[model samples]
Every structure is written in structure tokens, then in C-alpha cells.
Target: MHSINDAAGKILSSRQTVALTGAGISTSSGIPDFRGNNGLWKTYNPSIYAHINTFRSDPALVWELAFMLHDLAASTAPNEAHVALAGMERSGLLQGIITQNIDSLHQRAGSRNVINYHGTVDSAECTFCRIGEPVRRAALPVCSICGRTMKPGFTLFGEPVPPSAYLEARNLASYSDVFMVIGTSAVVQPAADLPFIARENGAFIIEMNSEETGLTNYITGCFIKGPVEQTLPLLVNKLNRRN
Candidate 1:
């Protein structure tokens, strides 16, 4: 088992290091995980609130959940884990961040090279004309171009992940010397497949999570068990000393 310091040292020495993050990373920022205890899924069915078909047929229902998420994102601040990653980017130890979250915390924390794999809540798209609109939390926003309701920019439950973000993330993972999986369960498709791509391409895979994930046993080169808020800062500190 490699120590966290050893992992940090490895990251410091690597030419390109990329991070893949999920809901767990934002939990410290007062956002709850989607599948954990007291998760949003427990109260709302994703089929109704999150699926693409539901958004097309009954957008109001999807907006109910969207409004709730908007409030949450508006109220929450970036946590230490988010800050640490942003610092790593500024220090040039990390190449980029590919996040499954739509909350925009990574951008808020000052990470410049963030790829939002699930899209962002800061804007929406008009379902009728496919025009983009800034998200307004004061009230539900309608499309100015077509007077149609707008859907959140995020990838819905049935919608495919955005092609450009997916391709860029894949390219980063393929060329990375160190690939870090942070707070993700590694169960979701497409995004989940990135670690395998990095592994196959000879990147050192690191897993940092509170508990073992589905990929813990097979894909990880090192597994550091702890909350990301605690573990990530420690890793960054170690990297700082080495730099």
C-alpha cells in the first residue's frame, strides 16, 4: 500500500495529471449525494425528474427538481477538496478536472481547466429552438427566442453525455501520467469508463474516496480511504513541499 505522501510525490513528478470527480466531492459543500442515505433519489424518482423523456413531455416536473438544485447550488460554497484541486491546477501539478457534477463548484473554486461532463446548472437550453439561456433562480426562466420552456444544461438521465466534454476528458485521461478518481462510485457509464482508458494507456490510477467503490479492487493503483476534504488537502500539502 502506498502512503498518501508517496502518491502525492508521484503526482508531483508526473507530466500530466487529471482528476475525475463526482457527488462525493461536493457533499462537504453541503450538497447531498444522489444515491447515498437521504439522497435526492430517495424522495424523487429520477425517471420523472431527471429523464430526457420526462423533460420533453413534462418539463414542469423536471423544473421542480431543477429549482431545488438551483437553490442548493446557489447557497453552497466550495469546500476544501474543491479548493485543493484548484490550487493544484494553479500550481501546475494537475492538468485538468473532469467532473460528473453539475453544481459548478469546480469553476467557483477557480479551476480553469474544468470539463463539466454532466453540464452545468448556471444555464439552460430552450427545448424548442435549442437556444441557450442563463439560469435565473428568482423564477423559472422562459426562452426569449421561442417563448418555450428551457431545460437545464445538464445531461438528463436518458440523454447522452455532451460529445465535446467527453472527447476532451478521454483525450486527457489517455495522455495522463497520473489519473485520480475522486469521490466517484465508478458505477456510471461513459464517465466510469475513463479510468479504464487511463489504465490501458499506462497512467497510474489513484482512488480517493471515503469507502471502497466498484473500481477499488480492479482499476486502482492506490486506494486512499477518507473524506476528500481531509485526504485531498494532505495530498496537496505533500505535493507543495515536493514542488
Candidate 2:
């Protein structure tokens, strides 16, 4: 396993550094990842609850899951890993972050240049009227303006990620000199392609997770095995000491 000092050295020497974050990063903040052993998917079948088809046909059924997400986002706070990334951004060590989590914890932790690749749970919008509003605790949320059914800001399964977010994240990946993959197994597509893009562009890849991910053997140059909440802060402290 590569050390945190090694990851810190890469970050320090890189001209442009970017991060790709996943559900694992926010797990420390009390948000359960969907694919882990104890993830919400074990309790709730994602095909039924997270599919756009189900959401469009049976909005109320989908709202059951949405309401739970709303509550979780409301109750949770950004953990040390999120804070460490934000600190890196503030100090100009990290250029930006591209996150697959729907929870807006990175932004809450003060990361300014975050691209929410999976969308966010912080707001809702009407499909008919396109008017956006804050997420509320309702069995079935509706748009006040057009009285149409509301959907959470997150991209449900079968829904396309917003084009702008995809493009921006791609650009960040293509230009990074150091790319960090944090807490994600990175099995999902489009977002999963980012590490490869960085590698193609000559970015040194750093992987930080509790266990080895698919990228660990493939593109990862430095594998720092541990919980990101612990590993990330350690890396940041190393960078700070150097500074």
C-alpha cells in the first residue's frame, strides 16, 4: 500500500489536482452508500425506488425513498474527508471536485468548485413548470406554481446526468496532473470513465478507500487503503506541514 505521504507528495508537486468523490466519502457523515454491504439497496430495491420509470408512473412510491433521502441529508454533516478536500481547494492545492453523491456535503463543507455529477438532494423542481424549490418533507411533493409532481434534484436511475455537469467533470479529468479517487468503487459509468481520462492525460492517480476498488489494479498509481475520513486528513496535514 502506498502511504499518505506519497499521495501528499503527488498533490504537492502537481500543477492541477482534482478529486472524484463517491458515496464512501459521505458514509462517515451518517449517509449510507447504496452499494455497500450495509447500504440502503439491501433494504430498498433500487430498480423499484430509484428508477425514473417508477418515479414517472408511481410518483408517490418514489417519494417514499426521496423523503428518506431528504431527512438523511438534513441530519448529516460533512466529515473530515470533505473538510480536507475543501481545505485543499481553498489553499489552491486542489483545482476542483467531481462528486457522484446526491448529498451536497462537499459544498456544505465549503468546497466552491464542486461538480455534482449525480445531481443533489438539496432541492426539487417541477417537470412541467421547471420551477425549482427547496426539498420538503412530504409524502408526495408537488410544485406550488404549476401543481405538477415534483422530483428531487438528484438524477434518478434511467435519467441522464445533466450535460453541463458531465462536460465540466470531463474537462477537469482531462486536465488534471494529479487525480484522487476517494471512497468510491467507481463501478458506475461516465463517472467511472474519469480516472481513465486522467490517466490518458498523464495524471498520477491516487486511490483512497477502505478496500481495493476496480480502479486500484488498473489506473491507480498510489493506493492508500483506509477510510477516507482518516486517510484524507492525514494527507492534508502532510501538505500543510510542507507548506
Candidate 3:
């Protein structure tokens, strides 16, 4: 891991800097980081909603996921890291943020250039109709039109990422000069591959995770081992001081 001062300065100096965030960034906000040994995936039986087969079998799983998501978003507020990243966007130091988190804290933090890779829980979509409709669940999910069923606007485990969101994230990673990966475990596929893709695209990789990850060995630029709340604010402050 590189020194914070050194990493922050250089990454801030980058012209077209961007970030790819994961659940670790929101763990502090109370949404448990999934995929860890005791994460949501491991502790709970996830077929309820995170899989296409389960959803097809019982559309109620979609409603279950939706309610859980609604409660999470309703409870967890954006933390310091989210605010700092939003500030970075406002300052023009960061071009955009691509997040794997389904929670919409980044939007609440006032981030403008954000591409949510996993869809959002803020809105629900009809699984049967697929009409790109907006249906909010005040209590439970019952589609007004088809009255079939509705689910969160996110990708299930067996489903592919949304093409529009995927393209936007890929484009940002491909063109970015500095790739800031914050608080991600970097174990998941496709989402984890973005940093490697960014490196292949001739960009500097700066990882800010609480501990070592699979990407650690490949980070030729910098690696800051600490929580995002501690690291991002300092980085933002470092950039703020430069002006």
C-alpha cells in the first residue's frame, strides 16, 4: 500500500478521474457488505430474490427483496465517503462514479455523474410486463396495470447487468485517467473486472479498501488500506487544499 499523501495527490492531479464503488462503501451506512464470510449472501438464503429462477417461481420473492431494499434505503443515509465523492464530482476532480451498490445513497449525497451498475431499490419494475414502468411499493408490490408482480429495479444473480448502465460504466472506466476503487472487496465478477479493464485502458489504479483484495497485486499506482470514510474525506481535503 502506498502512502495516503502520495496516492491522494497524484490521483487528484489526474485529469479524468473516476471511481467504482461497492458495498463496502455503504457498510458503515448500515447496509451489510454482501459476499464476505458473514455477509448477506452467506448468512441469509439468497434465492428469495437474488436469482432469476426463484423470482420466476415465486414473484413474491421480488416483493420480499423490494421491501428489504426499501427499508435499507429508507434507513441508511449517505456517509462521509459518499459526501466526499459527491464533493469530488462537484469540484470537477472526479468525472463520474460507477457503483455496484443497489442503495441510492450516492444520489442522496448529490452526486451528478453516477452510473448505478446494479439498478436501484428506489423504484420497482414489473417482471412480467417489462414495460420500463415506475411502481412504488408503499406496502407491497402489486402492479397497477397487469396486476402481475413487481420487483426491485436491480439485476438478480443469474441476470445480466443492464446494458445502458454497463456501457456507461465501461465507457467511464475505459476513458478515465485515474481509476479510484473505494471500499470494494474486488471478488465479484464483471464488477471486479472494471479496475483491471481500466488498467488495460492505460489508466492509473488507486484502490482504497479496508484490507487486501485480489486487485492488490495488480495495483501499480497506489493502494490505501483503510475505511472509505477515513480515506475519501482526506483525499477530498487534499484536493480541496490544492486550490
Candidate 4:
């Protein structure tokens, strides 16, 4: 509670506040994260199912995972954490969100300035034509332009993060005065470096997670320890009260 108040105070005072979200933010929406105890990666083996090599060699096989992700995103709605962030953005308390999720929950929740670092599950991109189409469950989707198989919109293991998205996220991190890391363990590379970037740029860090992460130990000024779904709304409420 004290931490939430402090975080809200910082956000209210800051010129720019940015949130870097992860899979844990969507877990309450019935989506499982990739690295948790019962994470999807444990069962699916990302090396075999999510790598670009596997996707290139056996696109049909890759579709199995892609379709599953699409159905899950289709089935679930954004949880309170996502809603709170969207509300903050709308109210001008937040600058934007940089997310590691492909769930599209942030956008669905009404957040306009979202940088989806990992891409999205809303559509699939064609390898040859470089065009994208909505994902379909009826069959393995093929590209309309070149008849090549379409790849899921989410970034695969071997693929680079979209350069444009990364640039936007990097700029946001570098400029933000307050940075919130929510529901991530801060382990994965590239995406994981965002908080550090914000820290290097002198941003005050606030972290909300079920447990302490590397950022919690090193950079976090306020560790609002709890489920993000619960903590984030509380922070929003505090900000509202202060206003």
C-alpha cells in the first residue's frame, strides 16, 4: 500500500511515465506465460515449435503453436492490469507501454501507444510477399500474394525484434522519467534491457510482480510486490485520488 502510494506520487509528478509489461500481466486473463512453472514453453519446447528455423523448415508444424496462441488470445480478454495501464494512458498519466507479450491485450484494452516488442497474434505475415493476413483456424494459412505459407505475427526465436518497434521502445525508455516494470522476471535479452535503459537515463523505477526479480534488487525504487492485476489498479486509484 505504501509502495503503491509512492509509485503513484512519482507517476503524478513525472513528466513521462512508461510501463514495460510481460507475460505475467496477462496470466490473469487465462494466458499462461512462457517461462513460469507451468509455462507454455515447458510443454511446447520453443526450440522445436517457436524457432524460425523450425518455422521455415516445417511451417505446418509451426502453425500448431500459432493456432493455439491465436485461439487463446481470441478467447481471453485483457485483465485489470492492462485496463489500468490503458486508463493511465488515456488520462495522460502514462506516456506509453512497451510490452513483451504478443497477446494484443494492451491494444484491446484501449492503449493507443503500445510498442509490441515481440509482435502480435492478431495476424500472420507472409515470408515471401511480406504482407500479413488475419490468422484463421479453418486451415493452415497461406499467403495471398505469393502462395507461400504465412508466419505467425509473433517473433520467432531466430528472428530479430522489429527494428522500428525497438527504436520506438528505446526512445521511450531513454526519455521516460518514471518507468514501471510489471510482471516480468527481467531475464530475457533485448526486451529485458528496457528497464536498465530507463535506469541509465535516470528514470525512477517501480516494479510490480508476484516475486522479486533482478530489477527489483537493483533498480526498483518502489517494489509493489503482488499480482499485477491487483497492484496496478490500486496504483491507478491512488493517482486518481491525488488528482
Candidate 5:
């Protein structure tokens, strides 16, 4: 088992990397992680809010929940980890970022090659036609072009993953030389499966998590066991030094 600093060195040495991020990456930005005490898991059941079924059935709460989260997200900014990822992308080592988080922090940090597996919390769409448009936090966010209910451009639990986003994440993972899994426990489906696919296609797997994410065994590559904000900056600095 390598210490945090040693793992950072090896990560910066790798090329053709694809990052897999989870809630932990954004927790520093005031977003709540699901597993921790103050996380969503401790606060609410996932089955209640992860899908449209809950929204359609009880919309009052859906919008209420949205309002709260959106209000919170509005004030949050990108953390050091996010900036470091953007810096890595600028150096052209990062091929893409596969994130389970709905927060747009990675994109905001200037990373253009992000694959938002869970979709973003910003944009909205017409539920019926699936045509998307930007939405603001007005008293009512209705569609001007179409007369349909406007919902956030995210995958509700029962909904299928958006094809374009899903395929892009898989393709990047498939061709990556290194799959960097960060802040995720590796228990989630689909996104969890992505690293395995990459590994099968000859990608090295690196995991970073504070807890035992159940993936430490399969990933023979480096594991930086610390907070992302503390760890990613160090890795990015190492990458800067190598040149």
C-alpha cells in the first residue's frame, strides 16, 4: 500500500487518463455526499428523489426539493480538485471526466471533456418532447417553445441514461490508458462498470477514496486515500514538474 504522496506521483506520470468522479469531488464545494452523516443517504431515501416517478406523483415536493438544492448550488464554487482536473486537461493528459455528480463543477473549472453520467443540474427540458433549453430560477420555469412541463436535464431514476452522454463516457473509458476513479465507493452500477471495461481494454485503474470502496482489489494501480482537494492538487503539481 502506497502512501498518499507516492500515489500522487504515479498518477501524474500516467498519460491518456480518464477520471471517474463522485459526490466526494464536489463535497468541498458544499455539496452533500451521500454516505456521510450529513449526506443525502442520512437525510433522505434515494428512491424518493432519484426518479421522475416521484416528481410526477408528488410534484410539490419535487420542485420544493429542486428549489432547495438549486439555491444551495447557486452559491457554491469549484474546489481545488476541480481546478486541478481542469489543469490536467489543459496539459492534455486527461481524455475525459466521468462523473456521477450532477453539479457542473468540472465544467465550470474549464474542463471541456467532461462526461456527466448523472447529467447536470443546470439545464432543463420539456418532458414530453425531450427538447432541452436553459432554465432559470424564476417563480415558474416554463417552456416558451413547447407547452410542456420543464424539468431539469437529468436522468430521473426510472429514466434511461441519455445515449450521447452514456456512449461518450464508455468510449473514453474504453480507449483510456488510465482510469482514475476518485471519491466514489465503486458500488454504483454502470459508472462502476466503466472502470472494469477500461481495464479489460488495457487501461490501468487507480482509485481514490477515504473508505474501502470495494474496488481496491481489482485496481492494481495507485490509490490516493485522502480528500480529493488535498490529493488532486499534489498530483497536478507533479504533472507540472514532469515536463
Candidate 6:
């Protein structure tokens, strides 16, 4: 029930504040969230397009989806929400961002300390040699050394998160004084556990989303309902005034 200004005050006062972001944060940039009313999952069966098994069996099919995503990402630009978070980090009010999104919008927005909890589309990795190459939208990106067909670096369904990213996100959540959940419903496992870990470690939890998520009542200390593009800038403005 706390206002955006109250949340901003908490962020400014906290010694260490971290943001956990998801597809919702990127929606303003025209990226679609995975589980919303118009989410990608609702249109495409994840098992067929986004599962590791599907990738192994039919990488070409998976690449079709990948190319579609790449095109979408290419056409989009970082929105105000992303810019605000990056500004917060630059000002030292926010320590870092942990994101479930595969798009590199946060990085594009100039957030230096970002943990890509769900990996990213910045490159494609060889399934055999594990070597990666920068994504090439004209055709499937391939590894230079082994010439193996490369897969997008994103964490596909049934694939575990990269260990280093997972550990860093967990450590941040455990050590933060304030943890903000932006545009995520907090239903996905592993990443969803971060807020609970933060709360248990005595960090205040804040949520900003267009609708009530599963964790809205259970974990949030402050719930500010709205689009992140609108809400985050207001919060940042409040923080700036306090500073």
C-alpha cells in the first residue's frame, strides 16, 4: 500500500538496494512478457519452441523463433524504466540488477552490474565446444572454431540457470537492504526464490507491476501497481528529489 514516493525514500535510505527485473520491464520496449495475457507462451507452445529437447531435435525450428525474437529486439529500444534503473545504479542508490529477461535492454540502458539470471541473446553458444559467437541475424550464428550450430544463450525450458549468474543473484538478494521486484510475477522457480531469500535476510521487498502477482501479498512490503515505464521514472524522480 506504500506510495511510490515512500518506496523511493526507502531506496535512497537503504545501504544496498538491488532490482530483480523480468520481461515486464522490457514490455515498454515492445518485448512481450512470457506469462501475461498476451505473453509468448500463450501463442506458442514452449515445449515445441523453447524447450531444450526441441532445440536438440530441431534446432532449425528453434532458430525460427530465435530469429523472430532477434528481429523484435533489433527493432526495439530501451524505455524509460530501463533508463531509470541504470540512472539509479549510476547514482549509487541501486547496487545492481538481476534480470530474468534474455534481451540485453538493461545493459543497453547502461546498467554496468547486471546479472543475466536467464542468460542473454547477445551471443549464441556451440552445443559441443561451448564456444560462443556474436549473434548474426542474417543466418544462424555459428562457432568460429568448431563450426558447430550454435544455440541462443538464453535458458530454455528445462535448462538450468548458469551457475555463476545464479550465485551472484542469490548473493545480492541475501546482502541487499532493499529488494525490488519489477514486472515479474514471481512464479518461476529459482529466480522467484530471490525475494523470499531477501525477506528472510531482513531486506524490505517492493513490487511494481500492472497487476497483482502471486507474491504480491506474500512477500511485498510495498506494492505499486502500474506499468514499469511510468512507475519507475516517478520513483527515480522521487529519489532524485530526496537526494
Residues 37-101 of candidate 4 have per-residue lDDT tens digits of 99999989999999999987998878899888888899999999999999999899999999999
lDDT of 5 at 22: 92
lDDT for each residue of candidate 5 in 1-243, tens digit (9 for 90 to 100): 556555555556666789999988899899988667887656556578656787777654555556666677778999999999999888877878988888889988899988889777787777777777665777545667777567777677777778888899889888888788888886677777888888899887777777656778766476677898998887777777774
Per-residue alpha-carbon lDDT of model 2 for 153-175, expressed as tens digits?
A: 88888989879999999999999
**Best candidate per TM-score, number?**
4
Candidate lDDT (C-alpha), each: 0.91, 0.90, 0.82, 0.90, 0.78, 0.89
What digit string (tens of lDDT, one per residue) describes model 1 on residues 111-148?
Answer: 99999999988889886787887788755678998888
Regions of model 2 farther than 4 Å from truth: none
Q: Tell me each candidate's TM-score.
A: 0.96, 0.95, 0.92, 0.96, 0.91, 0.95
Q: Across residues 161-221, which tens digit of lDDT does each residue of candidate 3 receive?
A: 8888988888899998899888886667778778878899988888899988878876657
* Residue 242 accuracy (lDDT) in model 1: 82
Residue pairs in steric clash, candidate 2? Answer: none
Listed per candidate, the RMSD to the true structure in angstroms reads 1.3, 1.5, 1.9, 1.3, 2.1, 1.4
Output the worst ten-in-a-row residue range by lDDT, candidate 5.
1-10
Q: Which prediction has more favorable lDDT, 3 or 5?
A: 3
Query: What local lDDT does model 1 show for residue 227?
Result: 98
Model 2's TM-score against the true structure? 0.95
Estimate, for each residue in 1-243, the C-alpha lDDT of model 6 and write its tens digit.
Answer: 579987987887899999999888998889887776898888777889998999888888788888877778778899999999999999999998999988889999999999999888777888789777778877767778887778988888888998999999999999999999999887798998999999999999999999998888888999999999999999999898888
Which residue window of length 10 is worst by lDDT in model 6? Answer: 132-141
Error of 4 at 38 (Å): 1.3
Q: Please identify model 1 stretches exceeding 4 Å from their true place.
A: none
